[model samples]
Target: MDDKYYTFSYKLRGDYKASPQYFFVGTHCANEFLDITKHDPLPLFNPLVHEQENHSPGNSPSSSSGDNKRLHPFNQELLTAINMLCISWDIIPKSGLDKIITFTRRRSETPNYNGIEWFNQIVGKDRQRRSLRIMIDQLRENNELKDLRFDESNNYLNERDIVNNIN
Candidate 1:
């Protein structure tokens, strides 16, 4: 059970041997964890799942109303904004966008506040196009991705648009 003497190895060693030559196996997820060495860790941040969803923005809730109706958490709101464009077919898109808008308006005293900077960072530069690719790929046979594109409608509000309006 000496961790230092034996780094974790892919092959279950029947007998102990001190050798760096052993290939450390990727995650036990098999297909899911395929090629771990070439990739970053699954949970890439202190708060992991959030980052996987785009970022690990930590969050909690507060409300001026005290009624809990508008008391949605901050991270949830941030995530909601990001989801407006970079969608996933898994679950919660329209609702996520609503939460984003609602949370920003309620929280930010600045009329200049918009979620675009964050959105860009989440999906990376030109991620809007990347998001489109993801959505389009979802339509293919192998890419049964969830449908979460926000621009499918003319009325879809965007954070960058809001920022432009404020500016």
Candidate 2:
């Protein structure tokens, strides 16, 4: 299949006459259950039934409580769905796993998603701030000109050429 891209936005609060929280982005055929790659997966599942099983990142083999075993029979169904998607697509998950963890307890304005502790370790404490300062300066001064040229011929192949390439 050719590459496809989607941008998902959760419903921002306002009375749009629709459910304020449920707005999601998806391909024409995709549904909420299949959006685990983009957001937290558990909320879409049966809320009353699911026992929280904390499998650390990379499925660390930590044992779940005894109740978890009883739930495993039903949990396998969830696994099957995920397995099928993994089998078909490369599953290049654009959203980081850390965001799912954070979404559970806190609101977005409280604490921003984590940065994996490496950017500060390697690039020093001020690198991010310095980069942002430079970006803001360029924006305000309007001195950083963007290259506004494109090679149209290379990108826009004639219909005949496109058909020929496909054939």
Candidate 3:
């Protein structure tokens, strides 16, 4: 029998007080795991779903006025935060804000997609997720986003106080 292992380490960009560094290690077989010859390549990220959702019932031509309505404040703030964090960390590039905004707008047009899941997909890989998680943890530890708390009523982060904090 043969055995193999993979190990990696990474650091967050800024001076976060909670945790400054991170490391990870895992075990797997090169033949079974690293070998992707049999698997299909990942599909291109598609915006078609967003397009379709925009044309759906409540948002159809007859109700075009709905397009003028603003996205929920909480969701808007969350996307802004994600964009800011990603750009600060250089995860997505200078256009990260545009990508985040486009993605968020698409998701907003679609009621069925899970926002958290969509976020995870955009981050795309484990390393990025780790970096983002650390940043969020630091933010929570420092109470930077104290105004954005989970609301029991809506089962999502409350954004009533987030308006003043966004900048």
Which numbered prediction scores highest in TM-score against the true structure?
3
lDDT of 3 by residue, 113-156 (tens): 24433443444443444544455555566444434332221233
Q: Measured by TM-score, how close is model 2 to the native structure?
A: 0.18
User: How would you encode candidate 1's per-residue C-alpha lDDT over 95-129 as one tens digit per residue?
Assistant: 33443444564655432123534443334433344
Which run of 10 residues does model 3 get worst, by summed lDDT?
40-49
Backbone clash pairs for candidate 3 read none
Which ranges of candidate 1 are over 4 A from the true structure?
A: 1-67, 70-113, 121-129, 132-145, 152-167
* lDDT for predicted candidate 3 compared with the true structure: 0.38
Q: What's model 1's lDDT at 38?
A: 42
Which pairs of residues clash in candidate 2, taking residues 3 or more apart in a chain or in different chains? none
Model 3: CA > 4 A from native? 1-68, 91-100, 106-116, 124-133, 139-146, 149-167
List per-prediction Cα lDDT, in the order shown. 0.33, 0.27, 0.38
Q: State, as a TM-score between 0 and 1, how close model 3 is to the true structure.
A: 0.31
Candidate 1 residue 23 C-alpha distance from true site, Å:
25
Ranking by lDDT: 3, 1, 2
For all predictions, the C-alpha RMSD in Å is: 16.2, 21.7, 17.8
Worst 10 residues of 1 by lDDT: 42-51
Per-candidate TM-scores read 0.24, 0.18, 0.31
